[model samples]
Target: MFYWRRVGRIWPVHLVALPLGIYAFYVAAKVDIDWPGLISSVFLVQTWFPDVTPTLPGNPVTWTLSVELLFYALFPLVAPFADRMRTRWLMVATAVGLFGMYLVNWVADATLDPTMARWVMRHPLVYLPEFLLGMTMALALRRGWRLPLHPVVPLAGLFGWTYLYYQERWPFSDVVEHQMEFAMRPMVGVLSALIILAFLQREARGHRGILNNRLLVSLGLWSYSFYLVHHAISRLATYEFGRMPDNNAVLFTLIGMAVVINVICWALFTYVEEPAEKWWRKHTPKRWLDRGGETGGSALPPAPRREAETAPAPV
Candidate 1:
């Protein structure tokens, strides 16, 4: 039950967070939320609609969930085809998919106003290539292909690209600058995949790194909850306190908020995400999950669980 597993992984936290975030917005921002948008948002289809009010409703950050939902719906169809392709060919297809995003972005930027262009670029369909890129890397790794990459190279590239692109520091013609702007999504996707591949290779080879420790690993586990709730908290804080003066004193406020966010995320993960996922798996319908004339639910044979690398990639 791939669909079931994905639903179980994603929905439990969303269900809890959605209303809570809506309430936070109501109290803090007094946002003129488009109510009908909530329905699409709950279904994780809000990003597919150009008319979505305020772009996202409820938890504004849940647009990523919309993207994930699209990926889940398409993964089975894509996976069978992807699994059959040789690693080289699979990468070729991924590259093409990513290139398609640049064209889509270019066309949207050329044809639409800035806001509509932004929305078009953000559409879930436009992001499927990033998902494919991750999958391609996973398959290539499994196929015993290795790249001579250190994580730092791509990590640095990511930071450098973000700075230069956002600040428009490079001397380029207007058309070239526009190309770089549109090219960001795909470029970042490739860089991100490379960073992940470097670490994946290291972990596969039984090496340990700073992130392999339990504290950070647990933080990583809590990150989804952190992502879900952090914005609401920030919204509430900003509304209550107003903007802090742009001085080092703001670091104290940031540190305090970070602590509070982690504490809340820890509670959310413990009470919601972990328990819900376990229960979801425990209760999945046999007919949906079992096809081999075998026992159902959590009865599948156990394997070494490197939870560090998985929370099932729904991210």
Candidate 2:
């Protein structure tokens, strides 16, 4: 059910977007996609064999989803072991995971070609450590570990550091620079977990932030669709508009594009993602695959049956 639910949630959107992505690439990059690469994409295992062909034949951004699919496949196996670790060990494991990613960065930097190195950075195995860090943080949080800083402060710090990293303002050795290129994924994952926990802590104490507000929450529901289609929309825009006239033109174009993308995302999310998820869960039997309660389906409990409603009254 966990697998099916994931398939149900993403597959429909991906299927619809796949051709659009191909068209976008053809428009923007003017490259004819290889069939083998597209096959890997269809199976959601493109990143596993990036040496053979481009993992992103349909959409470059969907490469991340390939890594995510691997994580999803491994979650059930990983979760039990992760849950059993003590908080101290979980914290230790988190540190180990971060360090491991740095090691992968160094190794890949030393060995692989630039193209293969880029692929290595996106590879699922290379990202296991990052995934492990998230697992560790989650377990520690479940065990009641609180972050030292407030959510907003750390969140702001994260963005600041990210900006500095991209600007090459951060000090870097060759290995560190190579690592740093994709290191943001794990680093951001850690910061994001902290922010989530801090927000949960605050909300528990009856405090709220703008993030908890309704309009943003409504938009968050469409985030998945936005993610799937945003690149396509942006690429199409780029294909149409050869280059920007100026900074102001760039800004205006981006703002206009964002508005159009969100409108389309809203429709796709409302009509495709939500309905597909509901239909799959409703038609499928409960506990079809595993005994675990987390099938990524609706969290609501089954409604209680009223005795008289199922039977006719005495006539």
Candidate 3:
């Protein structure tokens, strides 16, 4: 939601992040240890330096931002192609091509021992498939692809993810140690596609399942902000309280903190994100062409056309 809105009006989302960024910096600075490493990690500048800790609040998740940035840069170009090729075959081809690329890369990495393969995986080229999966699902629905609603898909996805996390021991376990884990990434993509398709199809049929509720929609709206700041919030909370000894106590405390922080972040998102977006649309120099053949100053162009417009104009 925030990504779409940001693409529509970039400046507002940047403005919204200012305070959050400041808060992150403030917290990091007040901490008693390793201010330089924290600063480098938080801003993702540590990626350039060798000695910096690889794992930090902001370092690990910065790849997602890179992926989002790539989307923002390429969306304008792909939007037209995606709009034109609205066939199920096109979607399938794209999905296959993306996965094929990953397979090729994985094979090459194994053969040549490319030290940078992990970094390459973090690149936007790799994860674009996941976002493309979502977009294709949306287009599939627009073309009347019916979604299967049996609980089997979601249940399978849940169990599969849990098993991958526990059995494979993520991050530490290599592809050689656990080929199943590496293979399951694409399956996770498939599962996510199914879940998204189900929700969209339900909404199209005017049947609200769980996501259509006002509160859930609101949470969805705020989910971006929550994702961005939740780690920092969690770290701060944990730091303030010190580490709990009991496993159950620690788990419960973390869960409670997550809930409280998510609520607060949601409120901030609604107030800061929405209003700032509106303000940007009003003031920004960008212009968007509307579907009604009119010009609007909004940042997002109209949604893609569902059907061909003029039958190729007789060539």
Question: Number of the top candidate by TM-score?
Answer: 1
lDDT of 1 by residue, 1-315 (tens): 777788889999988988778878764567777877888888888888888777677688998888888888887777767766666677888889999999999999999998899889989989988888987887666656777777889999999999889776467788889889889989988998888888887787787977799999999999999999999888888878897788999999999999999999999999999999999988878776567333333321233333443223221
**What's each prediction's TM-score?**
0.88, 0.85, 0.71
Ranking by lDDT: 1, 2, 3
Per-residue CA lDDT of candidate 3, range 52-81, in tens?
443232334453664666677666567566
Put the candidates in TM-score order, highest first: 1, 2, 3
Evaluate all candidate structures by whole-model CA lDDT and list the values in order: 0.82, 0.73, 0.58
Candidate 2 weakest ten by summed lDDT? 306-315
Off by over 4 Å in 1: 167-177, 292-315
| Candidate achieving the largest lDDT | 1
**Which of candidates 2 and 3 reaches a greater lDDT?**
2
Residue-wise C-alpha lDDT for candidate 2, range 178-253, written one tens digit per residue:
5566567667877777778778767755888878889899789989888888988787877787766766667877
61 in model 2: Cα distance from truth in Å? Answer: 1.1
Whichever of 1 and 2 has more lDDT, that candidate is 1
